[model samples]
Target: MSAHSQHNLPPSLTGKGATLALDGHDLVRMTEEHGSPLFVFSERRLRGNARALRDAAKGGHARARIFFASKACSNLHVIKALREEGLNIEVNSGGELWKALSAGFAPGEIVFNGVAKSVPEIELALGHGIQSINVDSAFELSRIAQVAAGMGKRARVTLRLVPGIGGGATAGIQTGSEKSKFGMGQAELKEALATAKANAAHLDVAGMHLHIGSQVLDLPDFLESVRFTAEQAKAIGGELGKPLQHLNLGGGYPINYVHHNPGANAGREFDYTPYTATQSAAAMLGEVAGAAAKALGPDAEIFFEPGRAVVADCALLLSRIENVKRRGALQWLFLDAGYNLLIDAAAVRWYYHMVNASRIDAAPDTEFRMVGPLCDSADCYFDVEGEYLWADLQATLTGVAGVTPEILAALKAKVVRLPETRSLPAATGPGDTIALLDTGAYTLEEMFQYCGRQRAKAVMIGTDDRIVTLRDRDRPEDLLDAAERQGIVRTVAAE
Candidate 1:
């Protein structure tokens, strides 16, 4: 299979055993060209997704700047591609800030976000002269003003507010909760804006920002947030006697993964899109923008910082199978990637839908208890309703890496162990290939080396079916090199 064909792997792939065909090339091609346990991103799909979001916001009238949340897919290459398309950047941390900067994102084109900003980090941003920092607290505003005054520069600050409407289905992620630690309250925001006005000579209050939460599926929740933001801006304008320059409704739009389906193995579905047609989450955003214009007048520019929805479907993770064993009725299927590579799996119970990349239309007739190669027992993606099968002597493992801790715990508790088998065939031995689907977001930055294992490799498939190594697999020597830089001097005198 070629790279283009593999990149176009269908939504539902079916075949006996764990076979992965990405773009057009099967797991064999991916492994030979790139390497196993590789993160392959589709450039065509990425640009298309970005363009969709931009079009959604503009409604074909004017261009609406869409900032790719670097926190989602912070790979420099990923950032570079998005930047090339004229998409702005939204960064959550100093590391992401550096990535965006290295990817050629202009200082003025980036939006610095996050509730907690360290002094040194803030100083770095102040020095770099990024466009605006979304201030979460009155104290942050004070710090920015102080830092800006010290540097003899003005800080473009945006106040992040809690819209009071919970976002996403997960109660824990809903940032709009009054109890959440995300944005500044209305009272604090008022005081912060007042303080900014008092220090207008040193601080420039750029806009008001809000990120309700991630994986938000409900359009009304976002629209309501927009309306609330517009209303608040209007009230603030009344106090300041000027309409704010920017109103950023942060992105948390949901994507429909295979996990949305029922069953224990369907994985954890946080953001579910029951519909996927003409009126999508993007359309809802446009409606929200129109509503904001109505409430806050036409001058206020509404900004959206969407991360997952843009990159989720644009990338996939391909892994190779190592072993398959059956403990009593429980089947243990091991792969090459684990939580170390999928940092998000440690916290968020997000499961990327997986299927044989080779069998685009394969039926969901079999299931398996999928586990990674990590020594930790918590690393597993067990599907209670899924069965494992192998045919054609192709011994390969395929599935998404980075199963969330929540789901792993459930797997640990035997929530997805195989049921009594009537006449199931014996499992295949090692040497099979498995692939994980829709892992484009935060996998790379999250992956860490643990237990002295090899660092995973990253590959990119080009328009010409050529495979380019994005990040090479780490060797034991690489670890020693890293350790040497950490000032760990070797024992000169032998014991």
Candidate 2:
């Protein structure tokens, strides 16, 4: 069977089919136990994704290691579960490093990567014996060497090279361009390797790393990077007269979201088939390793840092309908969750499938536009005033059935002017339950406490079918306490 068919999610998810089980419990019920606008993760889904990645990396010449890029979603419970599945951890900052440590990952089981590595942070990683540092630039490498020398320790490092290929479901996620402040160029990396060899006492240059981009739907792009990276490794090893121990291929694998949950409207279905093909990831990794083995002498281990692909489908963002507004013939769902929780809206704009968790079997009776409760005009995910891509263009031609042909022509003309604008034309009313499905990755980590609203609670449904709170809902007191601790407020200020 095709990978798409094996993992294709449907238009609606029943309580039994759902890993998190939306139908068995209501958002209101969860809110009572936890709070509103909660994030729910499924242990079953997390494990499944982990295994899928593991399976794809098997049968290759190189030993494939999968690391959960904890920057995507860093809840301690979620991190711990990934650790249990034997996935290594990838951290972008010291706080994330701490979280990975707290989640029971030893320093050697962690790979640290970032642009600005503070002196203390490098010292911390060296102190803890992290697996390797994916160095961003030559300057950072020198800093690591200096820090490691101070402690009389040798730090293992990997150089992250920007492959100049940027791709993702959204434009904002593409980070492989030369303009991006991510990794080092070829010239800089060569110089750094020479330096590492010259001073082998302070630094152990273990491997070459390359992350083309994130959320890449194109498999060939990744394959090309892998081939090129393997070649670079061969060349560097020849020039330095020593083979590197690891080849880190940073992850950009996309997940199958439809299998997780359909949209807020039960009637509308999302196409999830294109992404889940096992052969896609498998074939690409195999080809790359085959070439690398021939060139690099078959001894280096391959590492993959898959963040979004592992966790994106394992969680759902549950929000109650604070109010529903109807404008003309459109139905608008004003959800409690906004750009704060779903921060993807800050850059790439795409509609996450919203589903009526309360009414799973409801017919396709309503056509509507979904909106978030953020006060800013552009704060919501969808721009109602912008251009739209209507699945049924014929239905959009009519608004209340009295609109004339001339008006329809004008609207069509406007839509043509901005071809990429995607808007929802229909309005929805209040008191409905709406959900943003497959929001497990990057959503929670990017959350900001905007509008004085506290962060929402996060719940996880275990393999035992019981619900547990991953994080308690943030309260006003909690925010105030944090402020006081940060010296943003005085004790008398609260009084």
Specify the highest-lDDT model's number.
2
If scored against the real structure, what TM-score would every candidate get?
A: 0.82, 0.82
Model 2 lDDT, residue 298, Cα: 58
- Those runs of model 2 whose alpha carbons end farther than 4 Å from true positions after fitting are 1-12, 15-20, 23-28, 257-297, 384-429, 481-495
Quality of model 1 by C-alpha lDDT: 0.68
| Candidate 1 local lDDT, 34-145, one digit each (tens) | 6677788777777777777887777722435677888887877777878877789999889889888888989989999998898888888989999889998998899888
Candidate 1's C-alpha runs over 4 A off are: 1-20, 60-63, 259-281, 358-362, 382-429, 480-495
* C-alpha lDDT (0 to 100) for residue 457 of candidate 1: 86
What's each prediction's clash count?
33, 17
Cα deviation in Å at residue 387, candidate 1?
Answer: 19
